[model samples]
Target: MEQILDLETDRENQTAGPSGRMHLGGNDLTVDAGRVVLDGTVVGYLYENGFLRSAREQTEDDEDPDTGQWRLVDDLEGCDFQGTTQDGLPLSLPGPSSPGPTGSLSYNGRDYQVMQGRISNAQHKILGEYYGGGRFVLRDARTNTERRSLDEGSVINFSFAGTASDGRDLSEQYTRPLYRDQISYHENEIIRYFQDFDRLDQQQRDYVIESMRIWAASGILQIVRKKEGNAALGNVKHGAAGVTRVRTGMVDLDAEEFERDIDLCARFGPLAVITTRVPSYVEVRVNLVVSHEFGHQLQFCLSQAAQDRIDELYQARLARSIAKFPPPSAYDGGSELVHADQVMHREFISGYAKASVFEYWAESVAAFSFKESRKLLRQLDPGIFSILEQVVFTPEKVMSAVLCEQILNLQASLRFGGEFGKNLLD
Candidate 1:
């Protein structure tokens, strides 16, 4: 097995192992400008968060016939640094910079050689450059300067700096590996936004909209209700139907508890699942309240795993409730839960709810939409032969008794006793 090591806490100066530098205990080394520090010798496989930082070595001058200009000779043997953007966009390096001639390089399987040339950005044309052996050309459209050289791969690292694209000056800082794409934002902006928001009265609908956006920036989804004609609700898809606000909440209900909450609200999926903060009068800062609402949106968009427990509870309840029905009767070839491929998803059908699994499961899970609950009921009582036929149709062949038995067992586990079942039925 390959050994793993942390350079931050590991002791340095120890005899090197197969993993390269055994370990190092440096007091959080700070890199200054133009300083290169090696964490450990480049060994088997080295990974760094940033890019390699290095100074470009000056190349000797060579004469180009087309431009009749003296230019730096291309050196492929030297190491080069490569940096990637935030979304991993790779920018071309070794291209011409301003005030220089254009160049190209040819790769002969193992080596790369440079072809000298120049291009004019204004004219948008290559002046004069012939390729003898080099295959690739990198041109900086801005500056005519370029180089052609032989290819020799060398180790490189990641590095970067931070400044807003809007031309705001940022404090200069360097992190290794040098080629890493790091971004920094002004901290003062966040502080200012927060202070201004806290002082607002929640009664104003516009304040709720602004607050929701701010909360979203902080990764919180907030539910807010605006009085009328608020711009916040104008552009959102499905913004109407009297359901003004839906946001992700901030509270961290334990995984088990979250499952229980979902079961309780199985009937109100459309409504925002929130903390106990709503009041008849609007007075709180809209942003803070909206943060909780946004969380519900996030919860609604959860993966199947997020509700695995509730799904399991539903399955168990189905099985137990089936035990009460005789074989080849109401329980035998019933709803999709027993027949169709039932994978956990937000959509709830009928039949399953009336069977008793849904009632207890609904209460256990938190806020559910009545629409979903009613849909579950519609499935349970198909009303006529047409709906019943839909449920029992064997799109595939016959369902083995084993499959029915397995499902029944699952339902039994989810069945609730006494008052819990009564509350759901009521």
Candidate 2:
């Protein structure tokens, strides 16, 4: 959530400590001016009872008058200091004794516990830990394996537990569809029948919405639906004609068929299809299918440069597979040849990712959304991860201007009922 704090008013009421001095190691610090100094540099301002406000210099480019010259870096009530003991162990606050078993730290509106001197979630799984000299080691909560080590000031992207950074429950925000303005065709049809998002059961709805959230920044307009049939689990149509559509066929599957589908996906689908030992119905049917189709939509709407990069990666993967197993003939064709090629590509996330470059892209998109699958994708195919990170994954650079314009033109054309309508009117 956005919070606006008036620092000037806060500073006016600020009080000094009893002795106007503090001790740290051998240094005798003076706080008579309420400025926190370290190595002769004023790092922050100190308030009564050890509250701290970080120092920030306002540049000429900063035009926000309300923010002014001095900004409140973090919530005053929250802990802003990370102190180290004489033994060189990290501490959340400056105190003689270490924090208790239930000690927690609040950052960016989220609360994280300090378990045995490590950062943990509500489940008590270690997310990261601090060491001496401003070092931190981040670990994958699921595997408890080290992902990377970072400095104190470095930013790490993590899917923290409970509410989004905006202080809203992400699932609830997704309950009602977002970016409806982008949907220019088949709106009534999408909402009237079984395709309606509300028609899905709670479990199915949750999975589909979660998947949609992954591609929210792609700017690819789509019609998502829940269908009932045995013909196919899910599919997307994003050809030059007609509106782009995505549908999942998991609404009426029986117990046997559902289990069969799950097994089939485990062998040929994205990693999220079977994240754990036993996959849930929602994970197999909704998360996998929706994310995969949206991946296609992303492909259709991305810039030519981005698409070329994707094709380049796909060709490289195909070349590697072909190198391992020479094709039977230059004229070889059909599903048999595709299956053989897929088998040769040992690094593929799933059997289907070897089907074609398009399938590979879609499968990677689906896998990258989940933590377990994301780690697997990063390890098995760092090339795809790099491209995705540059174009789609990064929040600030999600889509280029040309791609955004293409989406706008598509939306405009779709709303006008396709190209033939203009000719007919003329």
Q: TM-score of every model? A: 0.20, 0.39
Model 1 C-alpha lDDT versus the unseen true structure? 0.25
> Can you tell me which runs of candidate 1 are displaced by over 4 Å?
1-289, 310-426
lDDT tens readout by residue for model 1, 85-170:
22232322222331222232211111112222222111112221222222123322212223222121111111112232233432
Range of the 10 consecutive residues with the lowest summed lDDT in candidate 2: 417-426
Q: Write the per-residue lDDT of candidate 2 for residues 76-137, one digit (tens) a residue.
A: 23334443222223333322222212234433234555432355444323344533222345
Specify the highest-lDDT model's number. 2
Clashes of each: 98, 0
lDDT of 2: 0.41
Find the 10 residues in a row with the least total lDDT in model 1. 413-422
